[model samples]
Every structure is written in structure tokens, then in C-alpha cells.
Target: MTALTTLGLGPLIPLGEALPPPEVAWRLALVGVGMGLHGGPTQALVLGAAPPGRAATAASTLQLSRPLGFALGPVPAAAVWGLAGQAHGVRAGIAFAATAAGPAVPLLTLRRQPSTTAG
Candidate 1:
């Protein structure tokens, strides 16, 4: 169930572009559920791996990277969007995003060493 829901977000842009307004509106209801299933696990993995009492701080740091990456990640794609068009831009953007995801994944997949208390 969760994996299916998570995977459904894979088609967000193309589905939105393909469907009529009514269908898009109806499918919009499923968007949150799908994203929650996908993103919740991701966020949990980030927060869960943080040290006690400092988890929130660390999570903030992790989330900060998100917006920072938005600026950093899509520069080339945005330039392409300006010069080329949305379709090419979006394709480039996705490829860039996937490349970014590749490096962070290994970092996040480290063995769960027990977190030491600061006290």
C-alpha cells in the first residue's frame, strides 16, 4: 500500500499535463497521500538517524539543504528552460535531481551506530 502510494507520485507532472481539469482536480486528492507515503519515510530516515535532543536541529539542517538544493540543483535546467522550453527543462531538471539523490543516498544509508547522549 505504502510503496504503491509512494510510487504513484512518479507520474505527477505528466498525469497533470495529460488529464482534463476535472480529472486533475479529482486526482489532486490523491497527491497528498502519495507524497506523505513517499516523503514521510524519507523524513523519518533523516530525523531518526539524528542524535537525541538534537534531532530537531539536525533535521532543520537536513531540510535547509532542500531549499538550498532547489537553488543549486536546477540552475542549468532553468537556464535551459529560458533558452529551450519547459519540456526540455523539466527533463534536465529531473536528471539533475536524480544525480543529487544518488550521492545523498549512500550518506544516509550508513550503519546505524548507537547515538551517544550529550549529557
Candidate 2:
């Protein structure tokens, strides 16, 4: 889902005035839906896989990566955008995101186990 969204977004950037406003709106809407679907399950999986005793810490640590990525991502993206120029910047950014996301997909496949009570 994440990979698809990242890949889908690149071409959408260049659609511009070629697409009807309604069609563009729907495509962006689908991307948002894909993001939301991906986000919730990923969070649950990360938290569920954590050591029971340290689950809270694990969740907190997991949450930290997001803002850190946001803080760090734009600098390099901006560099690529500046170098690539407006006509191609969006495609470069999309390619960068997809490449970064590719490896993480394999790591995300974790088998679920039945819950164990600590008491």
C-alpha cells in the first residue's frame, strides 16, 4: 500500500491541468486513504511486536522516527528538487521516497502470535 502510494504520487504530480479537477481530487483522495490504511496497521504491528514489558517505550520510540524523518527528509529532497528543476523535482522526490520505502516492506512482514497475559 505504501509503495503503491509512493509510486502513484510521482505521475500525479505531472498530471497538472491535463486531468479534470474531479479526477485529480479522486486520485489524491485515494492516496490519503491508502496512507491511513497503511499507518494504523503498521503502528499496531510495531507495538504488538514489542516486548510486553517495554511496550510503552517501544511505541514512544516508534513515534519519534516520524518527526525525525520529517525534519530530515526535506533537506535532501529540496537539494534534489533544486538540482532536478521544477519540471522533474516532483518525480525525483517520489523516486527517493519509493526507494527508501522498498526495503522496509520486507521487514514489515511479521507473523502474529496469540496474546499472553502477564499476570
Off by over 4 Å in 2: 13-24, 110-119
Choose the strongest candidate by lDDT.
2
- Please give each candidate's TM-score: 0.43, 0.65
> For residues 15-96, what per-residue lDDT tens digits would candidate 2 score against the true structure?
6335677756776676566666776787888887887898999888878986686589667766776788867776676556
**Candidate 1 residues 3-94, lDDT tens each?**
33323333433542245667555444554464345465667877887768999897888788756855775576456545646546544443
lDDT of 2 at 69: 67
Q: Give the range of the ten consecutive residues with the poorest summed lDDT in model 1.
A: 1-10
Stretches > 4 Å off in candidate 1: 1-38, 78-97, 103-110, 115-119
Point to the candidate with the largest TM-score.
2
lDDT of 1 at 113: 79
Residue 111 in model 2: lDDT: 82
Clashes per candidate, residues 3 or more apart or on different chains: 0, 0
TM-score for candidate 2, please give it: 0.65
lDDT against true structure, model 1:
0.54
